[model samples]
Target: MTKIIMRLQFSKTCAFSIVAFLFLFSVKAQDKPEIKIGGALRFNYNLSSWKDGQKKRGGDFGYDMFRVNAKGAYKGIQLNAEYRYYSEGFGGGMLKQGWLGYNFNERDQIQVGLTQVPFGIQQYNSHNWFFNLTYYVGLEDDHDMGIKYMHTSNRFEYQLAFFKNAEELGFGNNSEVSPNRYSYDVAGRNKEINQFNGKFVYKFGKKSASRLGVSLQYGGLYNLDTEEVGNHSAVAAHYELNKGKWNVKAQFITAAHNPENADSEDRAVVTMAAYGAPYQVAADFNMYSLGISRNIPVKLGPVSNLQFYNDFAYMEKKAAGFTDSYMNVTGVLVSAGNVYTYFDYAAGYNHSWLGGNFVDDFAKGNPNAVWEARFNINIGYYF
Candidate 1:
């Protein structure tokens, strides 16, 4: 059912888009649409010592995904789109982002169609490929189908958005439908996701290098009626610093959800913006993260730059039964022109419900809960 729904959405809404992209190069060569073409390829070597549903250690080395980006603007109208090819599911295909924008001025703009949500710590600061726990909870690197209006000033920036599809679920890109992944899906239970989000940021320090922001989110878990049922609300605060060689970031957030109508399992349903089947975890949770990084000026062969980052993230379920989780990641990223590589070592306690081990829970009398570790490396190049 999920695949069918996504197939319908693709055929109905994006058929023309796919065709246009296939001929994008020819169109650009003949007539200048002010088009820019670029793409990226990413692959990873990952080893998971332990996680939920996994009985033993496992690892894999393979391509993660490939993406192409195109952007152009004419007058006040702008067009941006991304097409992606994944390694798994639905013949390894999907759209990552596509949007149209109208800029009223340098500081005021309106965006229509799928775009990044302006909430929490935008884009995340983790040096690792996977962001943080908030990402799994739909607070980081989350996007939606919606209309967004934004305004920016020297000291302040704000955005208002209304989204209908929560993270474009069930689109057959296995990642969005997999219950074990960090995305969300409606599971054919809800008619659509209706959400309103607002974010405000204020900068105070010189060069606006120091910044703080607050965000509010409200999502309606609509079942059948236009009068929505089920309610989810979240609030978040974040601080960031960017000066010299140091880059620091921190965030705190919490959310509560009450599915107006209970699921068959009597679980509360809340998406928050996640659009995979696994994203529907019913509980209030608090999350906080701090990441700090410093760059080292050095040239290693073609690797002309080096950056080291230490990141920590924590998530605790407000409900009584769920296990709390945390993780600390340390890595150094090397940049060689348009290519980048990350060698990361992550250690944590129950980092996530799906991504953690049960060492702490299994130890009956032992007090020191052993921490699990995963080592990974990812190399990517942009063209």
Candidate 2:
């Protein structure tokens, strides 16, 4: 009788073990895939001086800025954030970018929060991946808190966005005007602006790999004080050719005139005249750039690979409804190392149409050159 009871217990133990194994296998099958998280940090330094009239001035050396970016992705959702700190004397300070995105399908997605606008290529491209070229155009710090929709397919992709307008962030008084008063007040604080942006990307080549794209953007700032409005627009195009380790890219952009809106023409004239004649009226801005980058494998000391590249840029600005133009040129060089580290050197020169006097300089035929240089060390990991 004792032996019969032992056999029965052993049978029950075997059955329990089988059941547990099956349960564990099922859980493993149902478990979601792991999400990916990664980020990078960057620091830059700029030591530069200007030479004018046999004199050297405007020289300083300091930590320019630091930036951190983080990103994560799960099944159909993505989160990205960036923070920046500009050292003293820079025009900007601590800034932040955070956004949450959801992909409805493989070809469509929506993002909302504080984020950079998808208007220009340079604005969105990662710094580590940049070709390191000096583009003579002014960098735009345009950010908005809003929602954006993007769609991409085999042959075409497009984006549309709407956001809060924050023009007051750029307001200040000049010495030529009241010390405590604003030069212009076209829009009230805390008002929302309507922004519309669109892009069409087309691909060609046997495998549909090469691409050409054009984009347009329009924004309106409404004054809550007077119900008046200011407008801004931009049109741009880009083309890319990729083959093996060699790639070439070119782009052009034009911006509509943007003049300060004031309560009265006298105030407007004073502000515009002080700023410059070209700024008196709204004007269009133009920028064009060409870049070529190649990755060559070279074994040198502790570094196994290196990439050498160069980029050139030209830009022009014309007053609204005027034929006069100012031009600028920028050149850049990059040397990349094997450990995902790089050194970038850039040089730039600016020429104004206006002469010596502020107003006449803006009028026409005024040309002077201002040179600038920047050097930076970047370290990052990319996946």
After superposition, the stretches of candidate 1 with alpha carbons farther than 4 Å from their true spots are: 1-32, 51-59, 89-91, 167-192, 224-228, 268-282, 352-370
Number of the top TM-score candidate: 1
- Candidate 2, pairs of clashing residues: 257-283, 283-320, 354-361, 354-362, 354-366, 355-361
Model 1 worst lDDT window (10 residues) = 358-367
Question: Candidate 1 on 1-383: residue-level lDDT in tens?
Answer: 78569748854564465334334423322243577989999998777666433334357788877889999865445789888777653236656678877666679887778787788877774666656666655667666787788999999999998776664444642232333222333433443356789999999887999889999988766554233466667899999999999999998888776555443433433432222222344357778899999999886778887899988987666655555667788899999999999988878775433243322221111224457777789999989
Q: How many Å off is the CA of 68 in candidate 2?
A: 3.5
Q: How far is candidate 2 from the true structure (C-alpha RMSD, Å)?
A: 17.1
After superposition, the stretches of candidate 2 with alpha carbons farther than 4 Å from their true spots are 1-39, 45-62, 72-77, 91-93, 122-142, 166-192, 223-227, 258-260, 263-282, 301-304, 320-342, 351-366, 370-383
Tens digit of per-residue lDDT, candidate 2, span 1-383: 77569747855764575445334433322135434444444444333333352124333334544556677655545678765555444333433567767666679877766655656563432133323221212222245566677998888877877654332244443212211111111222213356667777788886675878887877754433344555667787887766777667677788663434455432121112111112332235566766666677666665555555566655454643333333222222233442366565555443221122333222232345444444445454333
